[model samples]
Target: MSQMTSQTHAIAPEDADRAVIYGFVGRLLQAPPSAGDMDVLRALTADETEMGLALKSLSEAAQSANVNSLKDEYNALFIGLGRGELVPYGSFYLTGFLNEKPLAELRADMGVLGIARADTVKEPEDHIAALLQCMEGLITGAFGEPATLPIQEKFFTCHIASWAPHFFKDLTAQNTSAFYAAVGALGGVLVALETEAFGMAG
Candidate 1:
């Protein structure tokens, strides 16, 4: 899988870092991590911040993670018999149902931003993974020119800040979570950081 980066976009280093974190978390949530993905995770290093601590934990988890076990864990956590332990979708979290007004609003914003879902993707665009990927694209010019910080802040406030923190919290608390617990912790910290950063930008 190709890594997402904003180096070609002339964005700030901080924006590039934001894109990488969004892409990393989004990729892990989008599906089970392959062995290659695990390798990338294992190579990650951290510092002293909360996000760094979470990254350190995730890197440790990746070092010991088995691909097949992760596959099973992914299935159990995201794609069980009918539903998983948690539904990782913005609309569901916001409206207590799937495919609601929030999704329509997102679609409208996506249209205005010239963003379109892949034809191969059957899931709604409100899925958390899709939203994070959209943010990464917005930051890295994957969709077009890199969006301004204000625009990024607007999209994040409308779609991500409203519900993802709660979802990540639930994910961390999930009974079936093991490796994903690390994912949840990292996601939570990332969301908090994003929320604070956007607030400062605003």
Candidate 2:
């Protein structure tokens, strides 16, 4: 079982909010993003429950992508010059620069949530994977406690809901994207689903 799934608690329906947070984290960690999981991606667009399931499905599917393809995607999305068609860094999204205040803000939030950046990770804390990991920690009690709905809503609004979907949309449409295109589609759909679900819950 995945780390998040292994750590999940059976909270009451009133605390079901954690499931959404965990699901998003699981997906981001499973793959940087990919284009071959369209069926699961489409399902995620329908509802939060479906989104969670699709995320799990994609995470599992990502493991099966050929090694060559994975390397290609990594090269296309992160190593390409002249901005690589999509910037997946939070600093870029927030300040039009890499490793800027947005990254600093995310680091502050990580401290608040009891998340620490892995020493092995060379990327900035605002990288999408790091953000998702922190979200998982917040929802799964890896932090002080599972975050309340109000806190979850605030986090989503302040961080994720602000720009991740746009990044995903660009990933989907980027000419160099293939495996990541599906990831972008999934990210776009999931963000909309999460925003709508939270809005309705309010």
Candidate 3:
């Protein structure tokens, strides 16, 4: 009997773009933007498209913001005394509670994808930032193989497709969100782009 073996494919240029976008969004959401992060953001520009406009807006916001102000906003919007204005977790968004079944299912899938939770991270596996990071890893073969389209689509449909765009739309409207409001707008575009690409691939 032949043994089942794994295959690794090099990521195409277009898929590489998805990985970069996912990674950027993941980092932007995972924590407050640092001065270095803001420095890079300050140089960006957007075009006529929604994503471009969002990016351009982000650059404008970043120009007005420093590390301290961005930190304060991050704390206010995502890390208040107990919790923030928004909970960026899939479980919470999908089921209105934390530590729920959605989180459990995501953990199971993450293990199968060889995506172990980082030791320093305390949040559940279904956090939006973590999920995006996972998607980036899958695309770049950080977990193992460059994940096949079916795998990517399966992960996206089960985890992201349901809740993230809703969260982004909400984020963009939050008064406490300035830099992150722009981040949210960009995230909305990203969710759309990934969904469309995945649909075509599938």
RMSD of each: 2.5, 5.5, 5.0
lDDT of 1 at 57: 94
List, residue by residue over 1-202, the lDDT tens digit for candidate 1: 2223433568889888999999889999999999889998899988989989999999998888899999988898888899987898899999999999999999999898988888778889988899999999999888778998888899999999999999999888887756899999999999999988877867
Candidate 3, residues 1-202, lDDT tens digits: the string is 0111244557799888788888898899998878788889998865787667767888888888878887888888888999999999998998899999988998888878888887777878888888888888888887777888899989988999889989999999998967788899889998998888778877
Q: Candidate 3 — which pairs collide?
A: none
Off by over 4 Å in 1: 1-8
Global Cα lDDT for candidate 1: 0.88
Best model per TM-score: 1
In order, the Cα lDDT scores of the candidates are 0.88, 0.62, 0.84
For candidate 1, the C-alpha RMSD (Å) to the true structure equals 2.5
Sort by lDDT, best first. Answer: 1, 3, 2
Model 1 scores a TM of: 0.94
Name model 3 segments beyond 4 Å from true.
Answer: 1-9
| Tens-digit lDDT string for candidate 2 (110-186) | 66655676666676777666565656566666555677767777777777878887777777677664556655666
Worst 10 residues of 2 by lDDT: 1-10
TM-score of each: 0.94, 0.72, 0.91
Worst 10 residues of 3 by lDDT: 1-10
